[model samples]
Structure formats: C-alpha cells, structure tokens
Target chain A: MLQPLRDRVLVRPSEEEKQTSGGIVLPDTARKRPQEGEVLAVGAGRVLDTGLRVPPAVKVGDTVVYSKYAAMQVSSEGEDLLLLEEDAILAVRD
Target chain B: MLQPLRDRVLVRPSEEEKQTSGGIVLPDTARKRPQEGEVLAVGAGRVLDTGLRVPPAVKVGDTVVYSKYAAMQVSSEGEDLLLLEEDAILAVRD
Candidate 1:
C-alpha cells in the first residue's frame, strides 16, 4: 500500500531476462542490466507552472521498459520496490 | 542545436564543485555525484491518452536537480549535454 507522491511511480522490478531477444546467452558480468518492471502504483501527476496537472501514461499492472539506473530502490516489508519518475518509463510492452 | 523528442530536455551539466556548502572539501572518490544542470532546451511535452500535450514543468535556463543516473549523456560540439525527461528533474534551485 505504498503510494508515491507527484509523478513518481512504484514498480516491482522483474527478474532479469538472462537471454537476449536473439537467444544469445551472456556471462554474468557481460549480461545487460534489466530495465523492465511492472507498474504497481502511480502518483497524481506533476504540477506545472500554469497550475495544471499532467496525466500519467502508464497504469497499474502494465509492463514497462525503463532506462538503466534511473530509479530509486526501496525496501518495504521485505518487498523490493523501485521508485521512478514517470518519464523514466520508455516503452510499454504489448 | 539538438532538440530532444517528447518530454526530453537538453541540459548543460555544470562542473562538479569540490567543496560542500559548509566548505567541507572531499576527495574525488568521496565526492557525491553532481546532480544539477542548466536547461538548454525542451521538447514539446509528453502526449497523453486524451491526445493532449502535457505542459513541461521546467523551462530553459532553469537550474534543476535530477537523479544520479536518470539522464542520457550526449556530447555535441564539444559540449557535454544531458538529455533527460522533465519528470527526472527532482527540484529547481532557488
């Protein structure tokens, strides 16, 4: 039940997919860092100078791709969570 | 004159200050990563489900603080630039 403020999003980072899209296996150190997560919650949105609130693009349960190292890691009740700005989300998985 | 797309912004990262606000000097390795930058340009904002463009929260020439590694660094014309989404900007300096 942890909610973020403003345009921040709460995400549960998925386990890294060790294989590449082309099915190439890499060594532990050579593996690319995971950049995908599942949206758990979203904030009300960012406030603009014009007094308007910008709506978020992603919703709960959506699978999203984010930039590497662009999020904050927080632990709550033994659960691993990621807090990031909405803009960190680069794309939505179909 | 590189313009970012969507909600991205172009920023010029300032040189890292070796001294703290209280005049404490730290070694290079112990120094905190610089998180501040000056906005150089902004995109046309992010699109929403309603097909409306959300106004940006920060404008050109504003000093902003972003996450340690939330932005993409691109070098243009011998100038180091950072491309970050508006949401990655955590706060504006007074």
Candidate 2:
C-alpha cells in the first residue's frame, strides 16, 4: 500500500452509479461537479509551519466527494486510485 | 484592507515584463507557466485539524512565482489583485 504524503489522501473511486454504497443518491447536477470515492488511506496530516501536524478529517472507509479536476489518477498494485489534497475534498457522506 | 484567511495570500501581479523586480529574467519557457507577483498580504496561515495555524512562507513585499491556473482574480479598492492559496506559490525570488 502506498502512503500519501502531507495532506494528500488515497481514494478508490466508486464505479459510475446513480446511488452510492452509503445509500446517497446522486443528483444530476452533482454528476458534472464532484466525484465520489471511498477513502483507502489518508496521510498523517498536513505539517504546519510550526512543525505541528493537523490530523486528517476523513479516515479509512469514509466515503467522500472530491473535486473532479483536482484528483490525480494513479495505479497501484493494479488498482486504479485517486490522489488528491484534503482541500479538494468537498464533503463526506454520513 | 481585506485580511485573507488560512494560508491565502494576496498578490499584486507584476505587469508583463522581461525582467522581474528581483533582477531575474523570465525564461521563454516560463512565459506560459508561472506568473510573478509582489506579496501584498498573507493569511494567518492554514488552520490545522488541531486548530493550530501554519505561518505563510512569503511575506509582504516578497516577489514570488505562483501557478497561473490556481490564482483567483479579485478587485478591491479599484485595484486588481490575485488571491491564491499558499500552496499555489511556486517559489520566492530572494
């Protein structure tokens, strides 16, 4: 497993579907906006200028919506994943 | 004077010129890349998950290079300014 650095998070994007595993239905308007994914792993947190670390907001197994344009596609162990900064995450599904 | 929030920086982009205020000449390839600007104001720093703040890297009057696509154009006091995250800053021209 690859560990993301800084505030970056590793995500496994959900397949294209009208409904998510968490039972959240995607509205048509949201389809063109953000993409949905499952949190595979998160960085320890961003290192502050003061050398303190801020813990990640989303943890493993959390489903998140992230900026479509900001997610970088990478393949690890033959699995396609997304790498994005915490700032790019828009919302977390309950 | 608007105080930017959380690692945001207000920059006054330099006018198109072959040479920067720091005496660094713009390379031909750099023309389409980053833009040079003067730091006007800096945010307190990004608030960490721990509620701690990270100080900004660039201070007032510092000349910097920032990503063009990440900069947001805003107008204040009848002057054009660019608002960007501290992460957008590529380098500081010492």
Candidate 3:
C-alpha cells in the first residue's frame, strides 16, 4: 500500500462501462480522461500557514469525481493510480 | 478601491518595458502575458476546512510575479486590474 503525504489521495481509476452506479455513467467522450475513481488511500491533511492541519474530507473506498487536469499519474505494483490534492476532488458519489 | 475577499489579491499590472525593478525585467515573449504586478489590495485570508484562516503571504504595494494563466481580469473605474489567489503568486520582488 502506498502511503500518500499531506492532503494527497491515492485513487484507482474506474474503467470504461464499469463505472456505473446510481444508474448514471459518464459519456464516451468524457471517459477518455480519468475523472472519477475509488479512493484507495488518503493523507492526513493540509498544513496551514500557522502549522495547523485541516483534515481531509474524503476517506478510503469513496467514489469521487475529480478535476480531469488535476490528477498526477503514479504507478504502484504494475497498477496505474492517480495522486490528487484534496482540493482536486470535486464531488463524492453516494 | 476594490476590496477582495477570501485569500484573493487585487493587482495593478505593469505594462511592457515599464516593469523594471532591482535591475531585472521580464523579456518580450514573457511580457506578452501579465506575469508581474503591484498588489493593490488583499483579502483577509483563506478559510481552511476547519474554518481557520491562513493569513496571506503578500500585502498591498508589493511587487510580485504570478502564474500567467491564473489571473482573472477585472476593470475598476475604467482601469484594468488583475485578481489572483495568493497561491498564484510565485515570488515577491525586492
């Protein structure tokens, strides 16, 4: 398990046609870029200028929608993953 | 005077060839985009997830270099100004 640091999240991106939940799925054109994923790991929180930490909003196993251009690709054990800041996560799917 | 809110900074951008300071100036290609300016006003701070405020690093009248694409254009009394987040500021010139 990769441990991310400070407001970062490790995500396993969902594949095409397999991202169905709540009877809604992304279109093909939108699916070309990884936008939604399952949260695999979450960092502690963001540090403020005063040294206080702001806890992350999401937790493990959350299905989240993030900004397309905000994800940084990382590979862990032959599996492609995404690393994102807490601010990059746009919404959580119920 | 336009007052900004929530970690936003309002700046009056310097024109081409007029941004000289401390014996350094940005080149023409870089000058095409507004990258440097004098901060006119600043918001209180950024509100953290915990509702704590992170004080701004830059202050009014400071000369700063910022991310070119991060600025939002606003006009005040017919004078064009730029609004940016504190994070968009890359450096403060002496």
Candidate 4:
C-alpha cells in the first residue's frame, strides 16, 4: 500500500484517452497529456492553525481530472506514479 | 497577480512537448500531456502544529515539471489554466 505524506496524493492514470464530442481522435500531438486518473492513496489532512485536521475531499478509488502540468511523477516498482497535493486536484469525476 | 489558496499553485504550461532521447516524435497519442510549466502563483503555506507557515518552494516564473493527470483545469480570461497544489509539482527545471 502506498501512503502519501502531508497533503500529497497518489494517483494512477486511466489507460484510456479522452475523445472530443465529435469523436475525433485527438492525436497525442493535439491532445494534452491525459489528466484524468484514479486516486490510489492520499496523505493525512493538513493541520490547521486551530489544531484541526482538514481532511481532503478525495479518497482512494475516486476518479479525478486534474491539470496536465500539475503533479510530480515518480517511478515506483517499475510503474509510473504521480504525487499531488489535495489542492492540485480540481474536481472528482462522477 | 493570481494567488492560490491553501497550498494551491498556479502554473502556465510550456507549449513544448517532451522529446524522447531518441527524438521520436511521440505523437499526442503516444506522448502524455506536456506536464512542464512555469509557476505563476502559490498559496499561503499550511499552518503547522508548531504555528509556522511552511511556505511553498515554488515561486512565480520558476519553470517546473508536474504530472499531467494531477491538476485541475480552469478557463480564465479565455486561456486554459491549471490549478495545483505544491506537492503535485515534481522538479524545477533550470
């Protein structure tokens, strides 16, 4: 099991690519990197000045879409891993 | 100036794609989204239990590389924008 530190989060990218509403296959050259993924692990919430832990809104297994250029990539166990902070995440995909 | 909230960071992506060491043009389909960007703004640091504000390491104009699938995108002023937390950032490029 992977555990993030501080407000960091670990995410696994979805293997599929996003298609435009028109069904045009946005080539990898045209489409930005896939910015959607599944949450694998999350860090403990950050402690506020008031000594309260503000839990993150995201959890493991949650599907999310983030900025293509907003996370750090790490190689673990021969797999690509992403580490992000909670605020780096935008919204959860339903 | 844009200001992120609660460890959030604002980044402007570099419009260039990453080429493999062999110079293979990883098509948009073959390559991931360009996860490299320049830091535009950062949020105030999270308050630690020790009552210290741990400032973020990223600052405006600093070039960075992040995870493509780890940030949220927002449309601001007709430009595509990305919002991410500091932890989502990987390494700063010189």
Candidate 5:
C-alpha cells in the first residue's frame, strides 16, 4: 500500500471519457486528460504553521473527480499514480 | 481578475498536445486530458490551526503541469477555468 505524505493524495485515473457537448471527437492531441479517478492513498494532511495536522477529506478507495490538470505524476510498481493535495480534489463521487 | 480563496488556484489549460511516447494518437474519448496550463489565479495559503496562513507557492501567470484529474471546474466571464489547490500543481514550468 502506498501512503502519501504531507497533504498528498494518490489516485488511479479512470481510462474512460465521454464526448464533448459539441459532438466533436476531440483528439487527445488537442485537450487535457479527464478528471476521474479512484483514490489509492492519502497523506496525513498539511501541517499548519501552528504545527497542527489537517486531516484530508477523502479516504483510500474513494472515487473522486478533480481538475483535469491538478496533480503530480508518480510511478509505483510500474503503475501510473497521481499525488495531489486534498484541496486539489474537487468532489468525491458517491 | 479572479481570486481563489483558501488554497485554491485557477488555471487555463493549454490547448496543445504532443504524441505519446508510444506514438499512439490516443483519441480524447479514449484517454484523459493533458496536464499543461497557465496559472490564472491563486488563493491564499491554507490557514493553519494555529491562526497562520500557509501562503501558496505558485502565483498568477505561472505555467504549470498538473495531474490530469485534480481540480474543480469554475466559470468566469464566459471562460472555463479550473480551481485547484497548490499541492495539486505538479511542477512549475521554468
């Protein structure tokens, strides 16, 4: 299991997408990646200047939607994972 | 000008992309969006539990590469913008 440190989160992106409302098959060469993923790990949250820990909101195994371009790419065990802060996570999918 | 509050950032995604290292021109519907963007706005750093502000690292107008899926979508002045946290930003392009 991977554990992110200091407000970082690990996510596995979903390899699926839907067409734009324009009905145009936007090529990958023209747009950014989608923002759908499954949570893999979460850090202990950022430490405040006062030395307090801010726990993250989402937990491991949660599905979430984030900004299309809002996390760092990391490779683990030959798999592509994302490390992001809790604030980077926009919403958790139910 | 838009001001993000509390660890949020605004980004304008770059509209260009290159072929993957595999040379496969993956269609947008098959893959996620790219992670290239220009910073448009940023929020103040998160407030610590001890009444201190963390102050974000990146600033407005900085070019950054972020996770494909790590921010929220917000609209301003008829433009699509992304609101993300500082930690979501992977790297600043020098």
Candidate 6:
C-alpha cells in the first residue's frame, strides 16, 4: 500500500481503448494512451505556496479522466498502478 | 481570448523535443509528446462538493511540468495551445 503525499494520487489506469468511435481498432503504433482510470488513493492535498490546502477533487472509487503522460508507473501488490499529480486529473465521471 | 473556467488551465505547450536526452533525433513516428509548458491562463479554482474554493496551483507565466496526453490542442492567435485540467500539472518549475 503506497500512500501518496502532497498532491499525488494513485490511479488504476483503465484498459486501452482498442476500438475507435467508429469501431475500428487502430494499429499498435497508432494507438493512443488511455485517459481514464479508477481512483485508488490520494494524497492529503496540494499545498499552495500561500499555505492553503486545496481539497482533493476525486476520492477513492471515483472514476476519473486523466492524462496519459501524467502517470508514473509503479507496481503495487502485483498490480500495475499509476502515480499522478492532482493537476493531471481532468475530471471525475459519475 | 479564450478564458478557461472551473478547474481548467491553459498552457503554451513547448516545441516537441526532436532530439532524445542523448542528443539523438527521433523520427516523427518514434517521437513522444512534450511534457512541459508555460502557463498562459488559469481557471478559477475548482469548487469542492463542500462548496469550498480550492486555490489554483499555477499562475500565468509559470513554467510547469505537464502530462503530454492530458492536453487538448487548440489554435490561439495562430499559436498552438493546450487546454488542460489543473490536475494534469505535475509541478511548477521555478
């Protein structure tokens, strides 16, 4: 159990979307990174330079949209996980 | 003049790095997305479920590390720009 500290969040990246909106699976070289995931853990929150603590936007179990390049890959309990900054998260979906 | 609102942030994505860290020029097919940028605009802080206002993480003119996949490309005044969520920002680099 890796607990992120200071604006860091742990995400379980969703499976890559092989098919496009048109139902076509792109080639391996042309495949884009996945942009969605499940929220697993979050840091206390981002501390502003002014010393204000901004509350985290998403909570555990929240499905979120995240940038593909923002994640740092790590292995936790044999599961592939992504360590992301709060800033990289786009939005929470339902 | 595009003004982002509510957890959105605007960035001037830097030019793609044509050379590798080792100074080798990667071909277009092998090149990765750029992960850094200059802050151009910031949204008002995200509103919490508690109705609290979380302060923004970055300001205009700040250089930040960002996720490559998190940005939506747009043309602003003929310059390419990235519209990103505040969560996609990794860190402020001075």
What TM-score do all the candidates reach, one by one? 0.46, 0.45, 0.45, 0.44, 0.45, 0.48
Relative to the true structure, candidate 5 reaches a TM of 0.45
For candidate 5, the docking band is incorrect
Better of 3 and 6 by TM-score: 6
lDDT score for residue B38 of model 4: 84
Worst 10 residues of 2 chain B by lDDT: B17-26
lDDT for position B53 in model 5: 74
lDDT (tens digit, per residue) of candidate 3 on A16-78: 424442344444323222256799999998788777787777789988755445567789999
The segments of candidate 2 whose C-alpha lies over 4 angstroms from its true place after superposition are: A17-32, B1-50, B53-94
Model 4: residue A38 alpha-carbon error in angstroms: 29
- Model 1 docking tier (incorrect/acceptable/medium/high): incorrect
Residues A1-94, candidate 4: write the lDDT tens digits.
5679878889876675223313443444222433667898899977777787867767899887554445677767776777887766655655
- Name the lDDT value of residue B73 in candidate 3: 50
Classified by CAPRI criteria, candidate 3 counts as incorrect
In angstroms, how far off is B63's CA in candidate 6? 30
> What is the per-residue lDDT of model 6 for residues A1-94, given as tens digits with 9 covering 90 to 100?
9999988999987665312323543432222322567889999987666667876767899877566554587999998888998877755554
- Model 5: per-residue lDDT, tens digit, B1-94? 4556567777886765222323443445223544778998776677767856798888878999876453555555686666666777878999
Best candidate, lDDT-wise?
2
In order, the interface RMSDs are: 9.3, 10.1, 11.9, 8.0, 7.7, 8.9
Docking class of 4: incorrect
**Candidate 5 deviant stretches above 4 angstroms:** A17-34, B1-48, B51-71, B74-94
Pull out the clashing pairs in model 6. A86-B87, A87-B86, A87-B87, A87-B88, A87-B89, A88-B87, A88-B88, A89-B87
